[model samples]
Target: MMGVKQFPEFRSERLLDYLSTAVMVLDDHFRLMYLNPAGEVLLATSASHARGKAIRELIINADMLTEHLSAAMENGYVINQRNCRLELPDLHSLIVNCTHTPITLPGQRNGTMLELRKVEHHLRIAQEEQLITQQEATHALLRGLAHEIKNPLGGLRGAAQLLEQEIADAALKEYTRIIIGEADRLQNLMDRMLGPNDIPNMRGTNIHTILERVRELVRVEADSGLRIHQDYDPSLPELHADPDMLVQAILNIVRNAAQALEGEGEIVLRTRVQRQFNIGNRLHRLVACIQVIDNGPGIDEQLREKIFFPMITTRSDGTGLGLSIAQSLISRHQGLIECSSKPGETVFTILMPLDSKNES
Candidate 1:
């Protein structure tokens, strides 16, 4: 008989390396022994640099995490936490569901295995799907309504024009003129409500070019005190999108930020590239992230939920169609816009896929 074929043993570290959830191993003394790639991403540090560092040094506010790790190691208890907040070194915050498991071998020292799964990512994906669905339904309804309304509107305008030509008295013709003018204004408003109907003229475009166009426009129109700052990733690749549509989308967001700032606060336009990002149901290898951050009074909690819906406005004189139209434009480019606000800061983030392929 032929000799039995032998296969090399699979290493646990190799398995951990492929995991999507962040995994970190610590020695009994709570010193970092190993960090998987996902863990390195979560902590924003490399395994080579982070090895042997104290957990406290890696995470700024790790008191709660420390307590759980200590319990798991000291009592051999497994601990799981949901919606735990982790503050990173760069001041970015993460909400995660984490698990702590104690490990012991026959002759090896005690250790702990920690796993972190980001909660916000999952939540954001759900929200994005819902938003897309809601917008699609709203747009369909509006299209049907527009068809019904526009037919009568055209007839009314035509009737008014005929009356204007037939009227002998100048004063009575003024009524016909008002009727025609008001009909035209309503038609324009309806068109605005419907947003862009033309198919996006897509091509390879630099995101910075679109942002700069928006910046210059806002700067020219804004007050002297309104400052716009740029924090862009210079290495971002060209995106496949419509340059004009992107300009309009970003301009709407920046203009909204300026209006919120009331011409006296700072608005920062920041860009970055995210890898292995999910938008709606598709996963892209690379996605461009654009953020319009403003230091102004935040949006109301109630309004924030419906802020993207048409006709939802916080300002007395505001039309509330700007953001809705912006959302529509970006959606056409396979992107999403999300907003978060507090008392002094509001951020509008737009995520756009860089390529057509959906990577697995």
Candidate 2:
């Protein structure tokens, strides 16, 4: 043991211990090989205690997870995202979004290293980065489209009116009516698209109040057979938002949920605190999360990812702009909207950050 040089193992340990993020290094087996301090925080545990334990048992089923890593490892390098359902030992289920990116080291053969970062965290960061770019792009397009669209709309309406007066055929009038009606529809759409880019300053207001208003409106329109419930957190403070925009956002989601229920099912509006929430790729101090859930034939899987995009809808007569408008409004207020659907259940969640620095 004479002149035994110090290995970098201790130095590597120190590096993992101090890093702000949880970095776990797994071998080709997807085992719990090494968990840094930040990684332990993410899992609600410490590194010292999680050693040598099979990763599968610590969290929920890791079968889907192993595939993400294996695919990444087999390829040169891959970045994969997984929705991990973490069933903690306490019998509570917490869903975390995780990313598995392959890590290859020099002279390492068939390497597999997985990095798991919370989805909400990563999403917020992504949203932040994408917001300005998306806004600029959307704004430029909206402005240009509005001008281009409004001009054609006027010409169509004028031409339709002239045809109605000149053409003696009653059936010909039907064709003009269709053109005129479509022009008005396009005008309405342009209003929704370009009307609110500049508005009054946003204010701080009660979220439950907005939700209650939306619920009451829906319940008024709803039939006697339908049931609407409120499951709200009374302790949540007022959020910084535009009252009109907030109302519109809540109404769109609630209305969508109620319509899905179709007047004979249960629609629940729930409010809960997402202890540490992120939005627009930034970790907000605290967030107000409201879920509009319905028991009905759920949204189709193929349409889930595209639901927030403009002009996407499930209804035959729907404008396909409700969700898009609501999303734009919430985005202006620095909030987020997400939807999940399965058999007999669909949930639309909106997360809005609170303004108060100190707890009230």
Candidate 3:
């Protein structure tokens, strides 16, 4: 043992910091002794300020976690809880699989080491994959349906025009005019269902600019009662994307939010940079996250699931093509749109890769 080199304790601490799973250590009295980097990010608090705080103060419904810890401390055994809900101080809840291992100190009372691995990470990835598949399938089906409908629609409009010329009576001409008008309306609807036809002109552009353009357009359409807030990360690098398409997609989301608010609540246009983010099945080292958040009544649960599908809408006057078009546009740029809604909040997030190498 004389020549053997010992692995320093600090190296073990660093190893904890490197782990993706959140780790927290508590003393015999349940005071926080340590927090790894993942713990800080997950809890939205730094270790410097969180250390020495009572565990109950940092987590919501700490009683449930403490009950298990107390048994482990008394029995000197390890405990594992599957699918535990932990509400952080920030009010966001995460489902985690936690392990509580009681540690013994020489000639002293026992403490507990906690490891919390988020279960939502896998759940989200699976959800994204299903959503992307659904969107692609829906798009293809709609395109084929639109093409079939448009052919007869054009012929019907032409026939109506010819009939209108042949019918010298003004009364008959009015009927033909109505037919022509209806055909034109249906044609426009089918065109919208087809989504953007041109390929995206990808170029280096700032996301903030696109967001601001949408903000301004919505501000003009909406009443003064509506407020738009910008919470942007200035350090975000430019992403290679079609600014116009991004603007159109973001505008659709924002306009939908504004309409949902009924000219009242606030909408936030927020942007942030996500590191090592996944979009659909692909993973990227850097990604741009754009969020359109609104404090409205939120989308109905039944309809929220199919909000991005063609002809699915909540409003009576809505064409139902807005969100479908938006989703299609974002997909063209290799990004995906996801939504989460509750009673008081609705959020639509657009995740696009920021790395130029990821662009087509």
The number of clashing residue pairs in each candidate reads 0, 7, 0
On residues 294-328, what C-alpha lDDT tens digit does candidate 3 reach at each position? 99999888898989998887689988989999999
- In model 1, what is the error at residue 251, expressed in angstroms? 1.4
lDDT of 2 by residue, 54-152 (tens): 677667666777777788878766665656766665566655655666776556745455666665566556755675456557656766888888887
TM-score, each model? 0.81, 0.63, 0.73
Instruction: Output the number of the TM-score-best candidate.
Output: 1
Rank by TM-score (best first): 1, 3, 2
Query: Model 1: how far is 117 from its true place, Å?
Result: 1.2
Error of 2 at 220 (Å): 1.0
lDDT of 2 at 205: 85
Error of 1 at 244 (Å): 0.6
Please state every model's RMSD to the true fold in angstroms: 6.0, 10.9, 7.0
Off by over 4 Å in 1: 1-18, 26-34, 52-57, 60-79, 83-93, 101-112, 278-284, 314-317, 356-360
Task: Give the TM-score (vs. native) of candidate 2.
Answer: 0.63
Shift in Å, residue 109, candidate 3: 22
How far is 181's C-alpha from truth in model 2 (Å)?
5.0
Whole-model Cα lDDT of every candidate shown, in order: 0.88, 0.74, 0.87
